[model samples]
Target: MKLLHVHSLPLKDVIIDLAALFKVDYTRNCGEYSVKIPSTWGTGSIKGINFQGGLGLLIYDCNFNTDVEIHFTVNDIHPLKFLYCLQGKISHHFENHTDEHPLSNYQNIIVASKGNDGHVLKFHKNEQTEIYSLEINRKLFKSKMACELGKAKPNLQEIFNDDLGDKSFYYNGLYSLNLAEIFEEMKNTNFDHLIGKIFSESQSFRMLTQQLIQFDDDSNEDADRIILRKAEVSAILEAVEIFKAELDMLGSISSIANRVGLSGNKFQNGFKTLYGKTANEYIQFLKLSLAKDLLVNTHDSIQEIKYKIGFNSHSYFSQLFKKMYGVNPSIYRQNYLENKKMNRSQKDYK
Candidate 1:
């Protein structure tokens, strides 16, 4: 399906038009909107909130049956975007480039400037795309921000200073769990009441704050100096998928490198550059994170969880868990259970 000329319209109208084009069930009240498109177009739904002025949030949980393309223009005042793709891939095409920028699972991208002409958004068939998008008006941000950028914990002065319409300033990396959870919370309920509105705006601002802080940690000012070949990056991503599928296997560096047709040194270096962690470190992180989830969400023993993640040594597992989270696995699980109980109690009292 093709959606054209969506630029120049207000965001609300734009989304409404999109729903109409897809023949989806669309609803809007106050500033909150939800669209339920046909399963052929996509499954699940697309939800959004368009706040006053120029702040907006959109969440997509979908799998398209065929490729879909969106080409839209932007306003004269450039809008910045924070996009986190928790799953699947999206391809973006700019007017000036023959190539398209692909955003895959766990990837976060910041488009600091909207380009001059229209841009394209392409979604592929059978890809389960889960994405969170936040749009900010740069001019509004500068005017409304209460503090000076120079004194902020995360310096975003460089982003603030980029001339409007310059798309050169972009940052991309793995989407942290912190960001994923914040957006997930926004989607788990309907924030339509007065108190809900206040909470929604607060969460939106919090998401923005976290994005800036993450941007500070992940930004590369000299991207030209350290660029990975497309094939290399693609191979590394394939390796990542392999790791995800076989978290318990803990494949050797050379094996993964050989599978991807790269020297061990090159694979390690490129993995570190793209993911901000060595290949081994990334695998360990995934295992530990999955273990933590199982601990909190399942009624499994610590030993079982350890073995599930392929850790044979209990001492080694506890040591790594404590080093990363500052708590033992059992104690961490207990704390999580207690906190959950307390939250339930508080809600009952209310």
Candidate 2:
């Protein structure tokens, strides 16, 4: 692995450091910074924007020819960073620790190295990825958002209030879907003039808002506080197949979680993160969907269908079906049949 140490604070200095390391030139226009990867080193580009109140963004949209590890260091307090992997893969590990956090997909993680410890990012060879690092100079940001910080939750207060980087904090969670649109807009939109600068500056604050909100929510999520990593995402995906094949005999959440090599907490959290439902809710959704299919295509009675779907009570089954589809199972089936009959009659007449 090729390693380069970055000795800088603001986004501009970081871009200059990257330019020197890659043996390429960088540019600056209206305070936005950019450095393109030379063909010899990689492809695509790295861009950055520094907004007021100590908020900044660094974007990597490139593929390298070799594995590159960059160490971000500073003499004083290192900025707290919210890392977002919008696409592809990358790894992050503290300078003092070997426990690597692989970030990919739409996942986001927050890391604050203890005073002056610094951060290290590893990008794999030939894998193009777009990663966003939202850096917060806590001392400056705290002063800028003093009124807001006073009203923050106790947990958030602790984070934003840690201006000195006294604590080594790391929190990871899934789903930062809100920033996707902003990233697309920023990438595609022009940022050449003062109006463009204003647009980007506003967007930076919006991005910061989303990151802070998500970090706050993830920090206090009472259900599954376990840090789900990229390697374990496969287990979450496997759990879906188990849900599909064993709907009838599905066990307790703990047992099912154990079967999938996840703790119950992580199981629930990962399922919800990936599929937008708890395991039980996902199971219920699948059951109702299957019951609808059988109702439309088979001669099974409601009682038989309910039993086939592992539901013991017909009324409860009907209730769930109605809650999901806005009608009783019989009515839904009848409506489908009526629609099918109408379509067939029309076809025959034609």
Candidate 3:
């Protein structure tokens, strides 16, 4: 394990220090700092940007050849970090503590060290890891917060309300569905530099808000804390089959997810990742598809079709069917039959 110490403050300098160790130069655009990995070390890139009110984001997407540990050993206080692992795995250790915390894919950890204590992040060798860190300089952020920090839950309030970074905080658990969507958008969106910065800063704030809400939800003693797992791919498949077979009487997302040994958030995320739709959305799609098939192939009335496909109201079903297909269910059926007859006549004449 190679240890590279970073003795720097402010995000851009830290990236500069890191790139210095890499013996490469990084680009500084507006407030963003970015550096690409050298071929010798492996592949990928590291990017960091600091926004107003002391909020910042650091993204590390790397596949390293050897295990590397980057130690943030600044004499001053370190920023509160919201660490999210989207790909492989990484670990965290506070400067003064011997115990280490592992952060795997689809997991997040919120940590803030008191005073001058540092943070150490370890990246595994040959592991393709994508980790995003939301770094908050508490002293500056406390004054810039738009909402009331007091309204937050006790622990959260203490962490965010601390302007001087006197208190230390650490929490690790499953992130929220909203955050997952935001992360996807941040990664996939393309825009000009000005618009990109604006977009990123806005998304960064939203990420902070979602993380705070996630922390609150995670802290609720009654809430179940379950991270989505890659092994649960089978569970998602089972869910799809269940939805297909039970479209006529499909239950709520909660019921369906519970039936598949996952939480609603996990089910929604996994379903979105694999199938590009939420569980509820997929269920609706199945119902509509069955309705369409039965409309053309069977003699069931619209009301009957509605009931057969688990829609509670005939008018709602018709409205939704028209909204999706650009015509009401009755018209859709008539059009299908008309087209079918015309094709049959043409074939017979031919």
| CA lDDT scores, all candidates in order | 0.73, 0.84, 0.85
Q: Using lDDT as the measure, what is the rank order of every candidate, best first?
A: 3, 2, 1
**Model 3 whole-model lDDT (C-alpha atoms):** 0.85
Residue pair clashes in candidate 2: none
Best-matching candidate per TM-score: 3
lDDT of 1 by residue, 91-200 (tens): 76654555677789767777653456555678887888987778776666666664675566544876764446654556677655456667678768665578787888
In model 2, which regions exceed 4 Å deviation?
1-5, 71-76, 87-109, 113-120, 162-203, 217-296, 299-303, 311-350
What global local distance difference test value does model 2 have? 0.84
Model 3: colliding residue pairs: none
Give lDDT tens digits, candidate 3, residues 66-161. Answer: 999999998887898999988899999889887788999778898888778899999999999999999998878777663666565676777776
Ten-residue region with minimum lDDT total, candidate 3: 221-230
Cα lDDT, model 1, residue 269: 68
